[model samples]
Target: MSLYLEAATILESPQTTSLKAIIYNPSKPFKSPQPKLYALIVETLKFQDILKEVVENSGILKLERKLTPLLSILLTHDLLLTKSGIATSSGPLKDALLRHKARLNAEFTRARLRRGHADIKSLIGAVNAEHSRESEDGVTKTATGLTSFNPRWVRVNALQTTLEDSLSSPTFHAFQEVGSVSDMFFFDVVRKTYYRKAEILPNILAIHPSHDITSSELYKSGKIILQSASSCLPAIMLDPPKGSMVVDGCAAPGNKTTHLAALVGSSGKIFAVERDRRRADILEMMITKAGAEGIVTTLKATDFTTIMEGHPAWQASYILLDPSCSGSGILQRVDWDISKLNLPSSDTTSSHPSKKKRKRDETLPNGSASQPEERETKQLEEEIQDDDTSRERLQSLSDFQVAIILHAFLFPNARRITYSTCSVHAEENEHVVARVLNSEIAKERGWRVQSRDENPLSTWHRRGLVGELSDLKSSLEEQRRVADGCIRVHRTDSLGGGFFVTCFTRQVDDKGQFGGGIGNLDIVPAQEDKSRSQVLGDTTEVENQEWNGLSDEGPNEAVSAVDIADGDPRSGKRQKRKPGKAQQGRTEKTNRQFQKGRKGWS
Candidate 1:
């Protein structure tokens, strides 16, 4: 995935570069044996040496890396199969692997010896045992086949068909069939140890993590989506009643939008709004693929904030707001070919430090690059990081976020509105919730955090952190309840990534105006400076670390040093950043500092 992204603008972003590469990869399923290509890339990337020197090595082109790995791993794993085929350290497999160890090493040595003009077709033939002549050339090798390692978790897309029906079909039988796997020689049959997700989320299945279910017929037909158990929380917590109306603010690449469609069924109405035109197109495609055209209305290129009174969405009984944020809690998976794993110099310019710059670079220990372009990208990342933590940025994002929620609060029929983010940062999660709770709209409409006991996900072991609620105006006891009401998923908890979600409910009086009628609130947007100062007060704690969605270091991992919150929002397990230039701008002062940085540091 990273190799294909070499020429793209997303390559410079430290966040989600690998994930985006996979999503936008040309080899994805499109009625081709692209699944095989995907498998080949995934397995080959596990070998760290090959990935770094050959694929991620900037000296190579994007197309070259893709072609080389296909011939190398795919062909080798295919022809050099054991009797059972699966590459595991078992009785027969262990013996087979030991037997081929010497020969496999020799082939890799040969490939490296002729790296610049290596004939992949010929190397593939050598690896496949096609040439008896090459076999006697004093080469040692490791086991040729690889054991596939795929994480378990399957989401039943209730829109296309019921989970029961899909599981009962012949398509599911492949899990027990040895030959059905992509590699014909692989021996271990996929396990049938599928367990229903605990609690009210009946459609979610937690299968044994080792099984490869991506190629199942149900998955191919969109009867099931490979979503994590945690990602399905927000929609379930919202619990939108059947035949009701709902709005999915920030609903692009619509997983929750379609989930809402399933709950509402054909009789219900859903307005799926996305701000970006391109992502909206993808959302529309997802909606169509999920068979939710009748239930979901695609509001393409429409910002949730622009949605106001008199719009059909204003009458929605429920709203799911999952706005963008620093994706700190997002799980960082290592699977890309050209990753942030290394900040290499582009051919056009050298990223290495000069004699003077080497001295300047030593001042900042965490700083990684010396190249002007690389430094510029890092500086922009730092600025964005700074801005996100700055009271100004948080307040600005909070105001817009609160406005979106407040807008939902104004809905005449709104009852349950759930706010979520894939960010672990408090500003976007707890702080935003606290800010909205203190607003006049919340007070007047009787909007309060839904108690955990009432939420379907209340039984989840990892609830919201208590410390983040310190800023909320509620009593400590109430704050604890509010924290319990919120659902938090850790990145390493086997959910797709870190996430946070909480639902708000309004109790209306006998007066119809407050009960179910759409009433207007004259809200004056708060000044940025005032909002910042008010939200942060006079504390150094306000300057929290920005949560890069792709960072493996989670918020909870740093809880001892910083009291940052841990959670996620959205029912899709993870949220992706909207398309934009990742590298923004650089300043001269920053450049001068990098000019004195040391070489070999980055």
Candidate 2:
């Protein structure tokens, strides 16, 4: 706790503030931006972690699930407000925190420092000295891992050509085959690059960021795309049939749309829906660039739920629902002023700035605090739009997500549907699945979890959590089966951040019938069936509530009243409960009551 406070204080200092500006804002240039910029970003990321720790320990800021990316952004501003700084002066972060009344209790911060916690004075002194040096000479000791840590991944357009063919071509002479792992052979385009990930996909290549291939013939020809492996999982898991129709419910910046197009082939059709007109334009461009315009139809500025009965998309066999989430899975993003950097140059160059020079000092880091000076009040309102990480906001997002999936469930021919999110929250993942399964529509239409044995990515290893499936109206065995059906990838797995994917399928005899499976807690063993019935029958004298698992008893006393029923002479010899109409009806009635009692579990 003290460490977090100290780090926050250091990050909020005016010296750190000036250093951040000089490093991030090119207009406020300083000599030799490499070392100082790297140090500044590293320190900012450290402070981001510190802030996360503070939020987790504060115990007051009850985040719905995990901290939303927008909340993280706001928290950094609050960290600045810990002491007097520009971020504290009525800016958007401060304003947002104040508006929501979400600021941390001061007792958890500066008060800890005043107490006898382990001293952070030396750490503060060191950071201050480094900042002072950077301000003076615009240089500081560089941190490691910046170069090796950040890598660019490229996915080959399977519809165009194979990875091996692309690598063998004269245009890709600079690339070499990566080592054999995951039975996936990757190509390293940048020689001497440090390898971490073995494979993103069979066609995707993870390479060093130094390579400049954006202008290459292959990229221009739309034979390769820059997409992370994690983002590619939904399309892969959906495994749409060759001639089937599919819907990308929240399609925008259509990376997955093009990938789905390739999978479905030219004979198949796709309905790409996007609510935002501007993003829809970009999606259209990407679809065109990928040469999928023939098969991919764009539903520009349209909400997916509005596609009602008799609509062309209604007949689709597969639907991919990648709704708007908190985007907590994104590890990092690099943003820069492209117009300023790529402007025409003087002297003897071919128009635009030299590729090397343009790329220089363009390493703007994300996944941490933003450039404080750049993201003032107006920008915060524009960037975040609202408090996306708040409990109310999460509930809203979850409700919207549930509505999208439920609407998709109404599709008559929708045989397979994949619901995916970049969020790690149960409210959006397992809970959503449970809520949908418990819905009258899902039960009536025979929608249930597509078992792992039936899914393509069943061998991916990491599965959904069982603990989060407690609210689902299914037996423990069925719950475990459903958990195994879902897939989860952590942010640190190097597969392009955290992600969750689960496929829902409909069958003639889908076990999703309401009041059939109320979880395992209500089940009775065959050996105890007769005794249990006798106990229930004899309990006319004793209240039903008296038959709990156990109650306080002395050493010489019996553990439970249940033992008396087992030893009763009236207990039937037949151990099995007869599967007759009378017994089944009674069992169903009991289950209904049990389910009603457990309604508050979620």
Candidate 3:
């Protein structure tokens, strides 16, 4: 296949997969050189809007029946924007495009003039500036086409080195230090700069996204981590005391796990639980890389809900629950917007007739016209399918999120718990918070939303939406207070992405009991002959037993009815568990009681 056709096929890939991953996939290699193909796709996407307009105005797709919308757009991009013209052999396809060279050039010049650019260089600069603004906003656009500030947030890993030592290291020796994040946001494109963000978050810095820091020695040594400022909020908000026991309920890809380790120091211990074996491996690698192997215990394939009274993590005083939800707040790639380009319609009839009328059955060199049209239709359908965020999906996600937090509440010694999500929806944020706060376990354990004045992130201006908490059984004053306690980061706030975090706190008696009697809440059966010491020592061991659970990564993972049925507020039915060796000793009565208690939480 030609480069244009191959690049078009790559563009048709699902948005969930990263472009780099598709380009560099070793199993299914492309005909073109990977680097050259990747560059062509990226550069073409950068000028997609301009090329779309130029091609449509020139009527190239209409005149040349063989050229598809995507093909015309790609070929036209190189023709007008790149130093080298079309990178293809001299064929009928080339001849068709070359026939309209004069008209295409005129349309390209017209597009520049329409955008108020005096020259091509000035126009290209404007496009780069616009892209920079979009990156800073993290792809969230306002009504006025303005976006929030989104700088590349970097955290100095305290486990390996201090922030001061990192800044003075050889990796950042050439970088000019700026006074504010805004300075870095509007930095001179040619100069290297960074801004220290100490006012709200410590050991964090903001740098322009254009700067490539992944290759630096600091990053390679794990002395620095590429985490968003919003993602760092939970660890900072929990504020676990030095040498405290903590649990990261959904820890994987362990950015927050390592941050918690840095806070607890070598004297503290953290149990990072991840149910998925694949993600657990990634979490283990991150823990090792951050030099936190001694501090964090990897609980691979163990569900947070399974950590009952007998489990080692049940005694954790501090817990951070960043559970699964619709990742609507996550920052998207700026280049993904290129997929929404309005290419010229392929059905438009040609104004000029052929010199000698040829039969319509004669296929073009690439393919028949109908083939490209079908492909275009299929691509549009895939785009729409991938973007689906139906209300039913959100409801399912909210139910699972509420279940995770309620399970965290069951921890006898969990004094402080912070529940967070990178979701803008109230169904996953304020609604889930309200549901958990109103749960029977929370009421029995005295778990309540930590007041704003006591929260570590109280200085953050954006708070939870009080209007979304109308369903909560609280007075208007109380609801407002609860909303004020939650910290919300808007996608346009430039703090990185849209995020929501709220801390829950309660008092415990000397015997690790809240003021109420222990109810008959027999959820999971206690493990026999296991002590805290034994469990803690077995941190390095991966559990071979499989537990049905959902991934906290995002909405992509499927939610098992058996795993979340107890906490799912709307699920009225349960799936029967298949009898296996793991269920040998369990009686039917105990299973019934477990199911009954699970329904009570909802």
What TM-score does candidate 2 reach? 0.53
Q: Cα lDDT of model 2 overall?
A: 0.53
True-structure RMSD, every candidate: 18.3, 25.0, 14.0
Which regions of candidate 3 deviate over 4 angstroms? 1-143, 336-387, 507-602
Model 3 scores a C-alpha lDDT of 0.67
- For residue 498, what is the lDDT in candidate 3? 69
State the TM-score for model 3.
0.61
For residues 329-437, what per-residue lDDT tens digits would candidate 1 score against the true structure?
5543333544523322223122212233222112212212235545433322332342235567665556556666776776667889999877656677777788788
- TM-scores, each model vs. reference: 0.54, 0.53, 0.61
The alpha-carbon lDDT assigned to residue 315 of candidate 3 equals 82
The lDDT per prediction is 0.52, 0.53, 0.67
Question: Highest lDDT among the candidates is held by which one?
Answer: 3
lDDT: which is higher, 1 or 2?
A: 2
Please, what are the lDDT tens digits per residue for candidate 2 over residues 390-490? 66555655676677787787777777889988766667788888888888767767788899988878778778878789999989998999999998875
Q: List the residue pairs that clash in candidate 2.
A: none
